[model samples]
Target: MNDLGKLEDLPADYRAELTSHNLVPLWPSLRGVLPPGKPRPNTRATFWAYNTIKPLLLKAGELTPIEKAERRVLVLANPGHGLEKMQASAAMYLGMQLLLPGEWAPSHRHTPNAVRMIVEGEGAYTTVDGEKCPMSRGDLILTPTGLWHEHGHDGDQPVVWLDVLDLPLVYYMEASYHINGERQTVQPGRGDRQYARGGMLPTPVFERSAKTYPMLRYPWAEARAALLTMGEDMPQQEAVQLTYVNPETGEDAENILGFYALMLRPGQSLRLPARSPACVFHVIEGGADITVEDQAFSLTEADTCCAPGYTAVTLKNRHADKPTFVFMADESPLHRKLGVYENRG
Candidate 1:
């Protein structure tokens, strides 16, 4: 019997699935979410690593009653006390957010660079700053470091999306900052040109007036279409060689300790052989399994998981229905200083 509620009750075989995937936490695994010796069993690991060694389940059975009832965004930060110590570094924090159908997460924004990957949704749209990003499944909509953003159901049924933020990275560093958006809700396309990452004429870099990241959004659909039209395919043992560029300087997203996206397709998996930098992964669409140093776990839309630091991971999708994709992120502190990062998986 599989019981997601009790982490320890998980079937030994299923839980054993993670055996080979080495998950090395960036910080020594914390004793508990609250202060140590709080009698909470100290299972949680620095807001990022799963409390127990088992992979986290996102289904109704897995969530606490409050999380299921309130439709909140569950976060598992990277295993760091955290940095984003300043608003500038906030853009690098990543969070995994899930909203059941008809769930409306009241509007809010902070000084962190943010993005949403449509994991499971027939129809949804995120109005960022003021521009609306049509939420097709697997689409990536960026909410620049700061700017008001909210989710609404203007289409049919429920939707699931992954939210990534570098908050812990900032919080641990004592650089956390928050600011309420000026407007209650802003339209995206109907003449709201200033707030969008795409479909806008404003500069992408952070401005003196804004509290967070410089750019406002990066639409995944547009990026996906471009990749598909490129007439390219993944190389053996490798998905594809693609990197998010800093539009202003032709640099990679890591240059600024920034966040970015990576795509995967059916029967595609890159063998991540070793841990270099820590990253959080959000499944935008389809299905795939991750292998971290001998441990492996499969995931689908609305499902989020983290890859611990110093351990490499391989992402593979065996789905036959449509192309499976992922929106992945990392903290910029160490990567930016190194100027480069790579994965053999």
Candidate 2:
């Protein structure tokens, strides 16, 4: 018998008629379709240890060259969700891509907006539309939709970065498009960081899939300094956060994905109540205890955690020596755009 305990007892002819009309019994689905209380999500909070996956990433790079593999990535799959698909949650997709020295991931552009957060090592750069944005550890880079981009490493050591994209939204709309570039460009132009220049600028026309940031690369040193200044006025117990914004509008609320930086000093714990929209957080430095949806998880430098939508999260910096920094990539922009984003806190 079916879970409802009655659907299977229906007459075969009746079932056939229901199928012919493209209709099915709702009794078996009512529990999910119509719940008793507030809405709950299927996605779960999960964590990935950097130490456990680092060796595997290096091994993959050793076995398969970047040219042959295209993109060598280890996706942080949510245990609550099926592993067959590369996704962090139902709304977001996050992966750790490694680029070995002297290797390159051929240029390609797709519809899903992407944010690259550098985790370990450097001397690697992502070239977007003939402009090369050099990447350093803790740097955040934006690869807007439909922009040709490629990652290459010329440094002595391998480089790894978190690739967060809005895959669920793109797939749902059935608007995915990808095209490979002829070859990696040897020369790349520099982008202007207009916001840093402190000049008034006129509002520019907005396009659906266009460049949002005047500068694609957000360096770590500058971000750190800003966080430090923000901490001066912020309460000691609270976490200091800053969003990577589009200089033209001074907003991080892009069309699909959102990016931000968070810092928590030792003994600081910030609790985020249950909210709708999945978020991928990468540990930039230090260690902490993170509670996601009432489950406890330990995260150290280079580790990653996914707080799925409708899940409560709390971050505690118990380490005695240093501060904990995390880079967050989320689908809040898309949710906000649809006017469905919500939070209980």
Candidate 3:
């Protein structure tokens, strides 16, 4: 009687399923037989870097000898985000570029649109497809897909600027490619060359392509300086930093890969809405303690920090002598598409 063996070899799940469905049809409760969390949903994060990215810019003399001697095209890539899931169409990145007292970022071009915000140091110019424009701190420049460009600074001090490109966009599109120009890197010509060098009434000679980009440079420094001069007695905005717009379309260019500069007087603090795009901050002069998404960071001249999106932000000037000046970036172009807001004048 004890010679009979038990069904130890059979898995419990299979046995239960067989027992339940032996003589049955597809019943509604059959699905309940499985475990509660089997084949779970993907609740993990798709991106790696914090929505906020931090960058530290260098002037010519500040870097090591080796760093200064090389091709000075500095780049900040995704901070290693979207590691697995890979959100390509959307781009989130930041970087700071420094063209020493006499350095140049050679001629090159690729896909995935780009934008730059000049921070400090000037007498630098960027030549896109041979169209040149001297860059000044607080100006905005756009380099759309497939445009050839290069950078050089013949100024006294090193020219440093913020660089924002949607590398993720190129990676996502699976069309990523790059190339280096001649030995000198730049187009071997001087200020006499490029677009800005042409007469005052500047316009693209040949359509560089469709409505790729209208204006090469948006002089943010001059514009912001004017705004301050015009609104000397205006009440300060509580938490909102002013946005820069396209003069023609009134579209908020600041939201796209662009930069905005502001000066905060001593003891003055600005509170900003939480929904704005993540911003990277570089101190131009003086010092400040920034509250990003309520997270705090102490910064001074040459110091760098970042603020994430979907969280409120505030900037407080903590220094007495020099006024604190800050430069920031965001997805301002997309902001225009959504019609959530705009930048005028």
Candidate 4:
């Protein structure tokens, strides 16, 4: 193919006029926006060690009070996108949030969808809408778009969790904002318990539950147990993974991102095919060595990493006797919805 014309080839006066009229030529920049083969993603292979983040997060708790800072969080910003952007990927934002004992993150609802992966702590709970979801190590609690949510810690120690949100995407679309609300009245039932068992849902005889988000909190216990059981039952499967989905509709838990729990058997090394969606991996239990493209990361408990789209990734369980469990969030749902999802095996 012939090379496109350059803007420099044009006369100075013509170029000046084009710039003055905000009508620059596209030939010079066409290939940049529509590059051949695949996209050149700004989201790079980045890792955040929990050991390193924990101390900083604890110090942040001491330095800034909840009342003053509102939500004390240390954003896990990717260098590829610049630190000030506070983005882990093109569409995902990640931060480590701390809630000390007796601290309360006031009630507010936002336009971006978010979920909390409890890293460490006890006696901390998040109330979404009206459900008081307890915070335990490895639990995932959703504070979906426009849903009232707040955090409260009753235990005697500090509590911390990984905050994953679709703020970047929403902000880019100019639809990111939140509204403050009064303290919520605790509800009666828990969604995790109501939708506990698989292959069955609460069938309403009269009318279905009006709530758009039926299950807001996904307990790690159930997910871990399911992975262990799957490993035993399907011993031949290379990737013993389970998607966190709505039991009623059998879809991804949230609309913009897909959440999953993956288990690697002892001494297992699994290779994931190159797919057209950026993904974030958080270690829920055990240790694993991960390689994204040419970059490698050694992740332990509570560690988090992000891999760019259209790149193959490899995960290996570091333990010889115990399995490694990882929680993953990806842009697959958004890609599929936009008709651009791909799996280039």
The best candidate by lDDT is: 4
| lDDT by residue (tens digit), candidate 3, 139-220 | 7777666777778778887676666666654576798787766423333433222233212423448744343354567665
> Model 4: per-residue lDDT, tens digit, 142-164?
99999999999999989999999
Worst 10 residues of 4 by lDDT: 1-10
Q: Deviation in angstroms for 140 in model 4?
A: 0.7
lDDT of each: 0.52, 0.80, 0.56, 0.95
Lowest-lDDT window of 10 residues in candidate 2? 189-198
Tell me how many clashing residue pairs each candidate has. 48, 0, 14, 0
Q: Relative to the unseen true structure, what is the Cα RMSD of model 3?
A: 10.9
TM-score (C-alpha, index-matched) for candidate 2: 0.90
What range of 10 consecutive residues in model 3 has the weakest lDDT sum?
Answer: 41-50
Model 1 scores worst on lDDT over the 10 consecutive residues at: 38-47
List pairs with backbone clashes in candidate 4.
none
Candidate 1 at 138: error in angstroms?
Answer: 1.6
TM-score of each: 0.59, 0.90, 0.61, 0.99
TM-score of 3: 0.61
